[model samples]
Target: MNERHEHLGRLLTDAATRLGPGPPWLVLGTVPLDRPTAGSDAVAGGDELRRWVRRHVDVWPAPIGIAAEPPELHPDRTVFTPPGRPAGTYYCELHATGSALGAVQVGTLKESPSDGGEVWAIGEGALAWLTIALLRLLTSYAAHATGWGGAGVEARIIPAAGEGPVVPMEVWNHDGGAYGRAGVRRLATAGTARRTVDLASCLSPALTATARPLVLDLLRRFGLSESRHIDPAGVLRRSHFTGHDELIRTWADTIGVPSAP
Candidate 1:
């Protein structure tokens, strides 16, 4: 139950290569719960997990203006997107031991139908927003450790100590996780004329410069200050940060940060 994320950066890279991508248009993710007591009370059943997801999905995401509404579940777990279309079913698989919670993975059921286009064509804005939302959800549950892989993203978990860093809500707030995707895009466009990044082009490294910081910031805010960045071209950089004061020093050593730190 405690085993998760020992070789993060390299593992993710290899996954993207071998796995290719996650299923099209899926709100998929993993959360490693750090509950101390490994008792039957700690386990989450299907109904509990379904309710948990529904409650959180109501609050997080882009903003109230663009956030996903709570979903209506059918007996088969199919959701309301392009209703009657056999897109996919909702699912939650809990991995836990008697005293401690392992990982909780849920998929394909939290989002609403798109304004238009293919039911599976979830855009970059939704992708970025939901990504942050899922991380926040993990943090809310006091996850010992967590990371995500998208349709084109791959996350490799290197078996590490069952325990993870003492990440608190304060760390997430102070480090600016609340800024979310808007902050990511804003910071990325600081010195350039570009106002947005094309996340769909992720397979091409077209976003190495912008993508690096976005990914690194997620790691930092999640209390994972140490990781190795393996660029699409095969170059690598290892980063470590102990506190906010070292932010600049750390960025200079990160794969990408504003030139001035």
Candidate 2:
């Protein structure tokens, strides 16, 4: 493997080891925040996404909120909102093309936190869910960077154990906030080589078994297929701290992912 691929693999493996075994948790990655014009739609979409997640994943920790700030930094106390259910708050930062969209971050909540080992367990689960969200967002961003067009980009997760075939959840951008059914037309185009490499680099093997299906289903939903040339282990590595690393580290620390020596 190339240096970047090897490095990311090591990091993921180390993270998995540090996290240990726990309940099957979903790492939903970050969803992209559309520009200010779509602000209200983004809010509705966030709420819908949060609610959909609550249904599929067990043990949601509370005080979940979205922030413009990175997860390592404390969000504005005044802006934090506890979920209707009781729990400590965890925040996920949203982005679009490397710029922070503070105005769009207002008033988004995920779930409330629980206590004790349960909190750690839940945090790990939340990390998985967040990971998925981030991957999807990154995929969309990469597609745009590669010159793909179209509004209404989204990724959906249906738990493996859940009753039906897991399909991509339709995300409404400028489509009047309507959720589309699975098997819809492609929203984002097939990822470019760079996009594929970045995705492979960021995704850990430990997560592949679960995350792979979600990704494929999303591609299918978008009317695209996985690129044949993409090597999950050959992508060039940059700093792991770029993109969603701060949030990943914040959650990893909470769940006890080992720090690099």
Q: Which candidate should be chosen as best, given TM-score against the real structure?
A: 1
Which runs of model 2 end up more than 4 angstroms from their true locations? Answer: 17-21, 26-70, 73-132, 138-261
**What is candidate 1's lDDT per residue for 1-261, written digit by digit as tens?**
223332222323322222211232223233332323433234243555446545654543212211122334444221222223222222222233211111111112122222221111112222323333333333333231111122112211111111333111111111233221112111111011101222223223233343444444443433444223324332233221112324323422331222221
Give the 10-residue window scoring lowest on summed lDDT in candidate 1.
186-195
Candidate 2 has an lDDT of 0.28
TM value for model 2: 0.23
